[model samples]
Target chain A: MKRRLLLVSNSTLHGEGYLQHCQQHIRDFFGEKVTRILFIPYALHDRDAYAKTARQKFQSLGYELDSIHEAPNPVDAVRKAQGIFIGGGNTFRLLKTLYDHNLVSEIKKRVLEDGVPYMGSSAGTNVSTVSICTTNDMPIVCPPTLTAIGLVPFNINPHYLDTDPNSRHMGETREQRIMQYHEEPDTPSVLGLREGSVLLVEGNKATLLGTTNACLFIRGKPATQHEPGADFSFLLTDTN
Target chain B: MKRRLLLVSNSTLHGEGYLQHCQQHIRDFFGEKVTRILFIPYALHDRDAYAKTARQKFQSLGYELDSIHEAPNPVDAVRKAQGIFIGGGNTFRLLKTLYDHNLVSEIKKRVLEDGVPYMGSSAGTNVSTVSICTTNDMPIVCPPTLTAIGLVPFNINPHYLDTDPNSRHMGETREQRIMQYHEEPDTPSVLGLREGSVLLVEGNKATLLGTTNACLFIRGKPATQHEPGADFSFLLTDTN
Candidate 1:
């Protein structure tokens, strides 16, 4: 597998500007090799505004960004693109638009076959995994299926949060929700990517990037946490 | 419609025991006429343990509770049920189990046609609405469809949370989510039921019960808050 992927937990940290926290990682990942990035703004509602935000951010990093929504031919755009970046919003709407535009396989081919560097944040990150089953977004719109572009073999729970002991809300915590996901048969292990974290995959080797720790939830096993710079390459071959 | 439903926002309050906050509402909804309550423990994984907890709670309220999982014939149990109560857990798991058992239409018949008293908490309350699209749950499992019991014309977002002004989390707030839900074509209005809140529908009249306020999110209109005693009967007839 010759895949170069950057799966970010979130685009913005608490008080920071858009893509401020992960600026260095993005810069180093793209470098001078990839000059232009085709941006998928389908996850968000306003494509123009989302594209503008991403363009301004990428411009500061010495790269050009083109939104797929404005392209005459989306599939052609993916085929000729040097890199891909999908920003985050509602996952269902994103997946549905991807299907509507018929760009899932094209994007997969560009990354997996052509070795195009791929970057996704939040919902964009969620759709890059095995399935969107572990996403925390609401099903505001029904997509044809929860099946996503399987750039990675395992599922990802992005923007993963720790249970607040002080919270009085009765909704299931992030940990409990992932535990429930494991109850379903044939489900893959989930990587809980906390905010400020990124899972960078270069070929078969995957490394955990950022300041916080990432959690791994395997079926019939207790959820365990791993610190930054941890090797998650086993996730590529281990589907269980 | 002769439906008598109690759709609670949550089973347990922040600091209270299970079903403790809505004890009086549950009791008055059934009264002396309905002595037995049929419990659906499918939302949770451990049927036996969920049944035991519900049995103990209803027993203290002077009603005998029988879990449907223990019934010789689950559909038959619904036919003879004097009242129905569904406990909350994962909404996806609950809907999938309901489809597996082919109990969607049967439960609908018991509630709408026979006027069997129905009560639901959290996920239970979500399934009782138009669809489980507004539920604040992870899609751990895939159901055949998102279409639910439709005991109410509109959808209900249980465990509806107000934005925490103090929190640093970047995840979408409850308001932004429902606004996204409204983006879909022909989607019904959504009622955001706060913790310690219950929406009681008796015959044609729907009353907001409990101490906290319920919010109505109508498409294109701003979200508005309603008091505890406010009549939501219009929600039934006005499906727009």
Candidate 2:
């Protein structure tokens, strides 16, 4: 089966230059083929700028943009939709809603089982896990029952980069954090996506996209580094 | 079976205190019960600060801290240790070493089967997971591989907190990054541990240490709210 999981980062969707780069990729991947886009407005509660930019991108591609608030059975919605575009924002809120609406199963089927196009930036991309353990949000509001859509098997930490020396107080670096996770045998694979990097998994092939670097940490194995134009399918694709 | 799973996080060990807070909790849970302490110095590359602090902590607790450099067999070292006190630093680096030494399986047994008093802080805590999806560090170095000790079934993103609205574009907020992982299904549960939080499981009783004011995102369920002193055994404990 063939599926398209495009990991758009907050770095791109929030900035014009990065956003343009992301848009160009989206067009490159799904141009003309995309018909309808489901924009997840959960990330930006009061802000519509992300959604606005996404709409503009779709318009540029000659595809229709949709802001789905309430669906009549979200599973049915995915079955009928062409593209599910999750905007970058707070992924926890989006996952909470998706869990409440019970839309994860269908989305999984469409994306992984049925070859649907699932494009998410930041939180939108982060919410598609068995759990959102790798997120950077605080617990201002914990839901009554927290669950995720579970589109991918491992965790995706987007916008991953090196530590800034200008910061005060020294502690574990980003590389250290992921290494500690690998110290255990049961830890899942970690994908550290830098700005402009994307983990593109289409069917059995996985590609790393962007100008920056991304780190893949798998359990019981050494972490592998990948730069732009690297074949990440070496890590992400399931070879059965 | 009493197991000790070491957890190293990127959080301030004492949540603002100078020394790591593992001492305060040690007397109650481990204390005189601890006999051997195997110091994993892989994370603290050139910086001996964390390792030195770990030795002090164990000694103060009246436990023997065995600091060894050249391990003929890392797996055997862990197998013979009475307790493992993994110090804080960078989890990514420590995990890489663990994978290289083929100690992930032994580490898991130490915690789940052998019942060792495995105590860790900061990055030490992060490595207990199968993956460090929720770590708070910069990607300064590429990990040798991806894999963790697998003490816990879930991927842990330590030092998790929301973004401060007052801040400008600096680092990617914890929430923004973890949400990307939540969007996956096959990924395990994510425990976003703020400083002083411990997901301790004794016997069949699993309780989350530290603050209960956490956001738990599981697959197929809505995001749930957790408060300090809440009964999480129902949600987090192993009933099986």
Candidate 3:
């Protein structure tokens, strides 16, 4: 069986009781076959809080806990598991730990090469890009050189929403950023995920789940929207 | 005398009567002794269109148009004039032509090496950067390779605006591209300029002229807003 790549996107999981939602994405993507669920217990002020929080959510999904994979070596922790559940926290902290342990290679092996069912929400999607260019976070928490797992060529901007009137941010709204990406490269599509949106990429095909408000940016321009329950697929021959 | 740079940002020159406003900035920055004007007809659609456009705008500026300066040689064009005016049409077109003619190296000598006063609006500013990656045009116009005059390091994204709800664009916001730029390099700040806004880089200073909504990004994160009239001298030293 081919390893499934489930890229979950919901940024509100940082101490917002949103882990339950993250677990649902995991259950929805992978069913009863997921024996043990492992999470990187790194981001919290208290590291142990992540395991307890994730276990509670995992139990809610009607799955018995085989073992909770937690360690400095995310690659090793993930290798021992059948399905990996990466909960959300500050993208910076999680990325910093990943880089320090040099676990990017092993994690990529487990998911892309070894065919381990990989599940991640929020920062999980962020770590798949070449660099963390689209996250709504400051630069203080981690080194700028700390990039993602390079799952796709483009960056993943999770919990994306257009700007509201009261927001005083001078930054370009979510829509504008994707448009700019279209102007940069017209190939690798930038997936703009709203809450509850899931992009499942198996081999070269990517499908949009949840809301269709999600968009795709090719290079530095926006291509078009992927309607809900719609599938987005491209062949390797088309990309090069 | 040091070489001078005039940043005029009017896509539609006389639209908001910003032409006169831009001219005032030119006079203020380059001084009143600018007699002979070297018009870079490079920004116009064709040499014929370039001549006509130059003739019209020169008449509007209250100066007796002595010569059209329609020479394809940017270096020769600079030698024949006391001052220059780089008009706007499509920045990508102007940049492509400059890169194609190998005249960019000569133009750089006139502006950066020599003390010639260089003035450019819209497309002209786009040519000042090392590449035209940040201009406000469709990326459909692809030049084989980008080589700007190196008047500035990072790409200068001019004619920038905040998204309007009524607008019809489905691309990534300009901010998103700038943020993505940070993931690649923590240097090179993306300068978002609105109409009537100008960026004056001299010695080691980049002063903002226009509204207070200008933004700067570093390491894939939004920095702070730079208010107009503030001396942005730090723009020069804040890079690799």
Among all candidates shown, the one with the greatest lDDT: 1
Candidate 2 TM-score, true structure as reference: 0.54
TM-score of chain A of each: 0.99, 0.85, 0.81
| Ten-residue stretch with the least lDDT total in model 1 chain B | B178-187
lDDT pick, better of 2 and 3? 2
Q: Put down candidate 2 lDDT per residue, B1-240, tens digits, no spaces.
A: 565443433335433543345455565566575676787777666435655665676677777676534457778889888777666665556666677777778878877888887766666777776655555543223354345666656666566565668654434556545555555446556666665566665654556656425667665456565665554445334311
Q: For residues A19-59, what per-residue lDDT tens digits would candidate 3 score against the true structure?
A: 44445556777687775666665433355666776667777
How do all the candidates rank in terms of DockQ, highest first? 1, 2, 3
lDDT of 1 at B55: 98
| lDDT of candidates 1 onward, in order | 0.93, 0.63, 0.60
Q: For model 1, how does the per-residue alpha-carbon lDDT over A5-77 read when each residue is reduced to its tens digit?
A: 9999999999999999999999999989889999999887889999999999999999999999999999899
Off by over 4 Å in 2: A11-18, A47-50, A70-73, A129-131, A139-148, A165-167, A237-240, B1-240
RMSD of each: 1.3, 10.5, 8.5
Worst 10 residues of 3 chain B by lDDT: B137-146
The per-model DockQ list reads: 0.79, 0.07, 0.05
Native contact fraction, candidates in order: 0.77, 0.06, 0.00
Docking class of 3: incorrect
